[model samples]
Target: MPDPTFAGRTVVVTGAGTGIGRATALAFAGQGATTVVVCGRRKERLEEVAAEHPAIVPVVADVATATGARALADEVRARGEGLDVLVHNAGVFRFSPLAALAPDTVREVLDTNLLGPLLVTGELLPALLARRGNIVLVSSRAGHNPGPGSSVYAASKAGVHSLTRSWAAELAVHGVRVNAVAPGYVRTEAYRANGMTDRQVEGLFDAVAGSVPLGRVADTDDITPWITRLADPAASLVTGQVITVDGGMDTGAGQTDQDA
Candidate 1:
């Protein structure tokens, strides 16, 4: 049987060139979305994703910039297809202490992870309202859990959680639900852009895997199902929530006394 939850809907996924974003676009397409607009800064990567599914349409744009964000909205509106599901997944992460990060780097993180969502949502609000659609913000466990050398990234995600609740409250009357999906340490190419060497990234993943009760890091697929479910009509009553898919790492399921 076909899962036609979005058979005729239009879904937009930012940072869809790779990792969670790529997986998410594929999920919506698999669910039968008419058009899954996959946005990212890399044309080649976005094209690759589009090649995997006919429903996926690649649009290279930097959601972090207001101009880029508006351009994307224009493209979507030009198609005359109302937006049904908007997923804010374009984020940048640099694992460094506040002092070590350049002023511009901090701004980059905040712009992409925080302001980008706001800009895109504001641009697409009318379409979302028209369809009574939902928004899914891709946040991180760092929003609640503050590990060392990640203050900027964590703060950006914490802001995402705040936006989830704020937008949910503001859009409820209009029938547009807002929520977030906070993923744990997932093994993705995202780390490759995080300024970590191959060996260091592998070592970090190894250490974090031990803390998870499930005894492993997450893959992109591990986080995709919740995203699709949240946007589906089956979860109509679910809003203003942050669903943490972290393999029980944040739940302390396997933490001993000293670890706690």
Candidate 2:
């Protein structure tokens, strides 16, 4: 049976063009959310996802700017008085060693992964508070484990994790829940498109799987249901928590030792 926990909720999922964002938007629609606003820079992809799910609304905007965030807020306000869930899933990633990383790339990553959410969340805070809503930040295990060539991405997500905690505390009295989902090596098209050679990708996955107790990379579908659950009112008391859905990669034996 489909969960009806979100029957009357309206969810906003940024980065809904593809990957985890697409999966999460679909999941919320399947759970009967009244409205699912899918935001992304690509209007075509966002509209495609919306077409697949009639319940979803496509909002094509570069959420990396304050003006874009305000426009999204205005759009949502036009539909209703407030929103019940805000999923800050819009993000970008690039692989570059510290020496090879361009300043623009670092700034872009930080803007999209960190400041973009801050802008959107700030604009939507009043509405969320009015509805006693929930906020879910899509973070990464990179935040917890800073590896070589991921300094900027890791730092950006680490900032997100910190924001999750701070927002949880700040929004608590107002009854708005703030939490984060830290995903480990999930099999997304974006990951596949990374510059790694096939052998390198396979080796990375193999090493990750072997280290994780579950011994597998996560599928996009595998992570969406949890996101839906957290957005539900049933998770009313859950706040300020960064739940890692990393196939035990963040926890199992040798995980800490290997990284150290």
Candidate 3:
């Protein structure tokens, strides 16, 4: 049976173009969220996901600029007076070693990955506050332990992690809960999006799959449930927590296959 935990709530998911954002939007709809606004950089991608469910609403809004953030906030305001949940999943993770990083690329990464959440959340704070809502940030396990050639991306996500903790403490007084989901080694377009060729992507996947305790890369399915549950009333007392969904990745290595 489908969960009805979100029967009357409205959810806004940014970066709904492809993987996790797309999956999370659909999951909430399945769980009976009354409205699921799927905002992304691409009109067609968002529409494609929206077509799958009546509750999913598509809106093209870039999270890389204040103008984009304001537009999304306005869109939400037009639909209702309050927003029950806000998912900041919009981010850019183009990889570049420091020497290869261009000024513009750095700006784009910082703007989208770090500033976007702050701008979007600030614009929608009143609406969220009105409902005593929740905010779920999609950070990266790399934020805590950055991988090679991903310094900027890792730093940006680290900023997000810091925001998750700080905002939780700050928003607690107003009854708005803030939490983060830090996903590790998920097999998604992100590798290709990071400018890796298919061969490189496959190679990375093979390597990551080998290192993870579960011995496989994660699908979007592995990550969305924690997101939905965090926003649900069942986790009402949970806030300021960063749930790492990484197939036992964050746990340091020691156990062999036989130990499992």
Candidate 4:
């Protein structure tokens, strides 16, 4: 039977053009979220996903900027419905050595990965509080399990993890639940876009799969269900937790230290 946990609910997923964000948006729609706003910087990609899923409403916005984040929240407000779920999934990861890190790049990464979601959450807090909604921040295992050359990226996600706990505690009185999902390496276009050659990508995937206790790297789909579950009202009592969906990579036996 199709799950109706999200029936009549409105869900917003940032960076839903591709990867886990897209997968999470689709999953919510499939489970009967009446309105699924899929926001991303890539207009074409967002449009394509929206075309494939009638329930998806595409918004081409850069959540990396304060203006863009406010605009997105305004668009959601204009829908005239209280939000039921907000997935802060938009983020960026750059693996530059500390010496090579430019100030602009670091600022951009921090703003996009951390500050943007905080802004959007603030903007939508009213709607979410009215509905006692759920917020799912897509964090990274890198926050706690940082590897070589992941200082800034790890810091950004660590901040997200901290925010998740703080928001969960603060919003609990308002009945708004906050949580995070930290996934290990997942196969996505990000690898290619980040300048990894196809052969290198494959090699990295192989290495990751070998290292993971599950003996495989995850795809976007593999990570979506957990996110959806957290957003579901059925998990109303669950909050202030960071659920690691890394296929046992966090265990001492396996350590897949790649961005999800």
Q: Best by TM-score, which number?
A: 4
Taking all chains together, each candidate's TM-score versus the true structure is 0.95, 0.92, 0.95, 0.96
- Candidate with the greatest lDDT versus the true structure: 1
Q: What is the C-alpha lDDT of each candidate?
A: 0.89, 0.85, 0.87, 0.88
TM-score comparison, 3 vs 4, better candidate:
4
lDDT of 1 by residue, 1-260 (tens): 98889999999999999999999999999999999988999999999999999999998889988888887898789988889999999998887775688898889999999999999998999989989999999999889876778888899999999999999999999999998999888878878886778898788778777778999889999999999999998899999999999889787674421110
User: Looking at model 3, which ten-residue stretch has the lowest summed lDDT?
Assistant: 251-260
Residue lDDT tens for model 2, 98-177: 88999999989999999999999988988898899999999988888777788899999999999999999999999999
Kindly provide the TM-score of model 1 when superposed on the true structure, using C-alpha atoms: 0.95
True lDDT of residue 37, candidate 2: 87
For model 4, the stretches where C-alpha displacement exceeds 4 angstroms are 255-260
What's the TM for model 4? 0.96
- Lowest summed lDDT across 10 adjacent residues in model 4 is found at 251-260
Clashing pairs in 1: none
Query: Which of 2 and 4 is ahead in TM-score?
Result: 4
Residue 102, model 3, lDDT: 92
Tell me the lDDT of model 1 at 23.
95
- Summarize candidate 4's per-residue lDDT along 1-260 as a digit string, tens digits: 97787889999999999988989988999998899998999899999889877889998888878788888888889998989999999988787677888888799789999998988898889989888898999999988888876688899999999999999999999999999999888888777876999899899899878888988889898889889988877798999999998889788787555544
Colliding residue pairs in candidate 2: none
